[model samples]
Target: MSGEPLPPVKRVVIVGGGTAGWMTAAALSRLTDAGVAVTLIESEEIGTVGVGEATIPSLLDFNRYLGIDEDAFMAATGATFKLGIEFVDWADRGDRYLHPFGIHGRDVHGVKFHQIWLRQSRLAGRMGQVGNVSDYCLANQAAASGRFTRPVPDPAAVLSSFSYAFHFDASLYARFLRGLAEEAGVQRIEGKIVHVDIASDDGCIRAVELADGRRAEGELFIDCSGFRSLLLGDALGVPFTSWQHWLPCDRAVAVPSASTSAPLPYTRATADSAGWRWRIPLQHRVGNGHVYASAFIDDDEATAKILDNLDAPPLDAPRPLRFTAGVRERLWERNCIAIGLAGGFLEPLESTSIHLIQSGITRLMSLFPDTGPAIAERKEYNRLLRQEYEQVRDFVILHYHRTNRTDSDFWNYCRTMAIPTTLEDKIALWRAKGRIIRDQGGLFSDDSWIAVLMGQGLIPQSHDPLADALPIEEAGRFLDHLRDVIARTAAAMPRHIDFIASHCRSDLAA
Candidate 1:
């Protein structure tokens, strides 16, 4: 080893200022020592694509690590608790199922809970007493009843099996984080980036020239420039790999509408002819959007579909967004790291957009190069990020590929399209035996995979052989007891709106 100590990274510069940019700034500001200086530059002229965002349960960890109070954060963002996502009409015109946030029934005698349920369900089907899979899930049951409660820390508790996330106004969330980041010493600059200067000798970013004739220099750069990908794509020339062939909804029309009723503790994604529509409830309004392929439907028609399907009258004109489903060939290149929409985009099908940003932040922090960017660090970061993206891509593809909906050309194409070999193997494994291959560092758990697979109507012919080892009478009793426990626990929870009103109600003026 060299006698001289490695130099520390002194200055870090971030581009853009939406949820991604602010999230990066807030995290680094709170985590990094005073030796590092964090600065973010953004322009008021650029409008943010701030649709209502639905997140997964992992967001709780992100906030907790940053020491943010959950109730305070929710109030600032006009947020609502989310138990799970209810997918409607994906399998067939009238079919519905929930992809919940947490586990289902408790495991029995070393066999997975789902396996036991599968066996009992099969037997029940024969006896004409089959039950809806939702009854076995605490989150799904709570969601159905419009209830919400935080999970107890005790693993043995029935309520502890469930987890929760949030539905919040993205713009408000950005503003909320901006306040925190600024308080933690993140300097915010207001200007459009006119140019990105690269070091002639190393080809790394040296400084960004603002439109106001000023330049901001830094040793490291974080690109949160949304889909434009200013630093990574336009400057570094990183190539994008499009997954449109496998996942093809490329356009979305978003609008907010009046809330017609008490907000449910879940997001609703309903399938349409060309694509699907999303309904995310917030304290003040309902966020509605239709994600569809432009080839099959026009922008005007897509907007009309969204407006027509909204639960209430529009609050404003619909906004349109266009994006391709894919990520850059490498997320980290040289001294610059790309996060959020700039790194890539997978449609909010499973509401993974913000979670991807959170993951990127966490990974960057874990492999943080205090001595400046190293090739090895960049390689490992890119490798891990690629795995994360691919894992989510495969899960999203499962929803489309396994669907029985043959109602439209869109559905037909999705059902028949060739998929990644990774996804193909997963489907094959599940079909052969009810086994879900879990990704070690993946965002979605085995329960998530099981929910989507079974919710979409794919049933394995056989479960784990160990599940059958139990006597039928015993297994049936275990199943009955589990269902009863979950249902009763869910019934005792307060209504979602009541929980929010009492614990985290927004103080924002109408």
Candidate 2:
């Protein structure tokens, strides 16, 4: 970029159509100008592993950027509000905790609420019963009590900033985004990528030959072809860096079930002998899945576990999905970029699949590739995507490694396995002083680390000293106030289901 003109890679072809494909389409349509051409080629024949229905709060930004109507999106996607994720038995049998969206209570006396809570626990000399920090967190309290609302917190207060995400049918979301992107000038082609035409000397893909024998050429290519990675890996030969050793869960069996009970405001992930089960409450139905280590469990056993653990009667046959845990060595190389499952797969242990896809799209926009770069830009882009993936990977691994469970071989293995050095350092720092070190490019925030670390029983050796600055009686009053305020605010919100009924409900929701 040092005086060199941005190389023109005007025509772009995206090769797939699920959440990733349409998400890419929606973003590109917004960025590309009138003359620039964007074509997306996806066949209806190939099935999508459309179980990526849960998301993080950050998705609000994506929707806001696209100016997508919230009610319309909800109606089209059969969406339910997601306040957070509930981890059941991750630390030990029968234990449950939530990793809520948004921040916890307001920092008091320039100290985090959790730190103050830690000090209060020490003052009370309560041993086994750790302070329930979430008791004061707005989103957590609201989720616990089945409440939902658009936040209108006072500028000086903490609860005002509570955030939320959504649980929607993935296929419907893709369709919804497809409409947005197409209406914004993105051309959609229905076909399979039979072969990738590449420039022989540079090895950069030039076009994709559709099964219909029509040639769709582009100066740049986006590979959203899911696991096959048609353009990036399959055609271009980009290497994949596997992380199967650290994240042992390689397969999942997904099934939708009829609504059996009132939908929970959060996703529920329950631990088991071989792996874990996810219950995502969509407005109309529940998306259930069992993700397990294929090495330790068979398809039948895995599917059985999923069916046995379902909260409602099965609505459809279970669908199996398989993948290794890792990312493409280079998400972008030459003129091609890989997004979504083509880029990597970290178990949705934290509902990060959509988040990571968003990350890739955002990063691609920032370091948007051209026919030529300064060489440094490519290096920087690769470094950033690599770091993003590693940071997210480690965060997911922390849940498995920081736990106290040992009831099964899966649990025993996870409990003792060595983790990434980066995660180990973070854990060590938190234990030493209850301090969290944030990676500038990392997606997870300090509060996020605290929530998971404390939820999984990683008690810090010492509390934040700032907490000691306040007198014990004063701290008690503040903590009580925080708890009471959260209770009242959450109580004032509409019931979770009622919120949808009154504000966002539609034919899909029913």
Candidate 3:
């Protein structure tokens, strides 16, 4: 097997044309410098599912790799900086919390900061003065204050401790990337795929037949065909695995609304009777959606729920989408690789849709294969992506299952549903002792789990023994000083809207 290297790939073909397709195309276009030909096929008649998107901080790395200017990208997408997600009523009615982007206070002498804070909170006298854990998070405080600023390079700076993502128009982001991808020599074909021809010998995709009878062939095929999974599922016959029993929300109704005020620096997810509502603020409009289990709530009620909860008048009629909360049994099959919805979905609850796409592309690039047999590469790719999806799946399910809501059947089912053993183990560890063990390559950090666990009223029975190393009096003083520093730093930043206006205001917004 090690005698000689396989031939290099010369042509790459991508199916579909939304955020996933364009992102893949744009990223792979760099290979054009080495004479690899990249082509993308899509139909104008097909519409994309994303209305507005909330992203995580990892996108910054992807943009940097693509050489995208922050200001230019924001302006092109009518983007608003996002520091975190504000979850309302998830734990119980009237309960709320913020899952911020960065770490919560600095760790003290190699001891986790949360352990120290948890230990301090347990003290009867210091409970009120120490304040909520949110006080120690810069991103949380800044988001609550509607402030925005880029992180500083100095790690010691309070301002540099937290990170920011974005709330933007997803279609516009795809359009922006389309321009970049095309400029970098990616060929876009305007047509729908009518058929996929599979080679008889290896059962690999040979070429895609278009409605107009044109055929596009390539050595490597990328399946970004959204939920259709045209190449990977349809052509290669990969089976779909459903995680609906755990994550029961199966339908969503999304709509855009006029902005009543300045855009906040975070996305909002509010728990509802049957499901939940998401409000993502962009520079030009507010994106609202209701994700509900169709078994418990009808489409009309779900749609009505979102409409009634909007802060401003509607800009258009509501759009509906249906999906199961699961991933494919195998993301990489034969010679075709699935990215985005084609691979699987864990819903947009944590704003992980776009991030998943980025993860798929990053993984593919790392294990990019040549024209010869790629069995080992394919297995590794599938393993990595499957782990990522499950990790994200467990995180998302934590939001629903940890809830105290009993007002609706949907909540009842979610609250009592059987969860994957992986999530069960995670929650068990945290409940016993305030310890968070992150799986390798997991998307969320220990801080994220801490935020949600505590936010959902799942405080542990005890703290780490090491948290007792600091004297109570000294710990209280440190907590007081850190809280004050975070509050002051956040207050010093400009308002979210003001920062965008000065740096990256879109013409539509202007």
Candidate 4:
């Protein structure tokens, strides 16, 4: 059975007005051209958790789909380019690695690049020559040297090998997108939702009531209410599934600090005692936050740890955020769909906060329903989003679970704790054959898994046998040539700060 179908979605109401709401509004505003109305409700009194300062390359596609100008968006949001995340002390104290945004090296005869590098490095007398896997990646090289450039479309060019994202002010990004969405005929209502009205016959959300005695009705409802889940959870009675046992860091203290140096073109996730701290470099300030497990450390201690670790003076007192690492059991329940924090939060370990929101919006667009009671659509969306969330969850858990740090109870528990069976299987496969088996349609690429697994010191038991097709001497020469070309190409690129200065400098800090 194809399930029931009702009237087409005419008016779409989005609850909340942070990055999620505006991003949803902006994306759905395109529907207005097809005679669909989009309305967004937000309260000025309730501030947003605006600390999703780092993003992945997928955001570039989201912005492009919305027809946003790259330089203008960057300038408005005080954004700097992001090659990838630099993980510090994840595997153990004093360890560092880059989970870069592009491929490692050119695969020879359909064999994966890492397998070749793995085979060559494991051979006697070639360990020093091959160096770390990071050496073969262009993104890693550029990030290490503070270089930034837009990738070329030419497959032959070394510059085409890597991609980039952004480090921007989340609040400003919301505001920037708000202007676009509003300009595209999206209506905005300023008010707090005091009640959600559910229909009797069907469990679909009928409308949302504001505290100021206003009612906004719509055929379709999107919950971007950030942790509140006003429509989906509160009214529709959808339940949340907690992943805390696997991902235990439940609290975060975030603060903005003055930029001490030129902004680096990447985000930094440094391991802390109770959890981990993030360092995101924007043009104006550095976004710093300590995400720690409250069970092992108090709020005061977490705040102090972040303050003490700052490279520059604080711009504001630390702000605290509380959340469970989980998602709603069903992302789309009935006619009400949840996006962003309202749907779930997997932490910002991989800088996936915004990406998840974008993913939801994209999936919705693809499975966009013209009628009410979109049963098949909802089922597919829930399945896709659930898979995406689990994929990201496993990747995040890998950082915490694969660590060698035993200095604190937090690390000890994380290191010794049992992980999900899915993650276990992935790790086991990697251990067996240096092969990264990524789920189909997963957010992260095989290169991403390779980076984190190898960075955290999880080497495979053996290389792919296909890597042995090429002679050892030939493979060594190929690695040397690739490394030299990447180094020279990276050196030739403009500095990250320089690229921003010439293209998209906000000048807000100055």
Model 3 poorest 10 in a row by lDDT? 1-10
Per-residue lDDT tens digits of candidate 4, residues 442-474? Answer: 988999999999999999989999999999999
The pairs that clash in candidate 1 are: none
Backbone clashes in model 3, listed as residue pairs = none
Query: Order of all candidates by lDDT, from best down to worst?
Result: 4, 3, 1, 2
| lDDT score for candidate 3 against the true structure | 0.91
- Candidate 2 versus truth, CA RMSD in Å, comes to 2.4
In angstroms, how far off is 482's CA in candidate 4?
A: 0.6
Q: Cα lDDT of all candidates, in order?
A: 0.89, 0.85, 0.91, 0.92
Rank by TM-score, descending?
4, 3, 1, 2
RMSD value for candidate 4:
1.7
Tell me the deviation in Å of residue 151 in model 2: 1.3
lDDT computed for candidate 4? 0.92
List TM-scores for all candidates, in order.
Answer: 0.97, 0.96, 0.98, 0.98
Model 2, stretches more than 4 Å misplaced? Answer: 1-7, 124-130, 370-374
Q: Write the per-residue lDDT of candidate 3 for residues 385-468, one digit (tens) a residue.
A: 999999999999999999889988888898999999999999999998789999998999999999999999999998999999
lDDT-best of 2 and 4:
4
Clashes of each: 0, 1, 0, 0
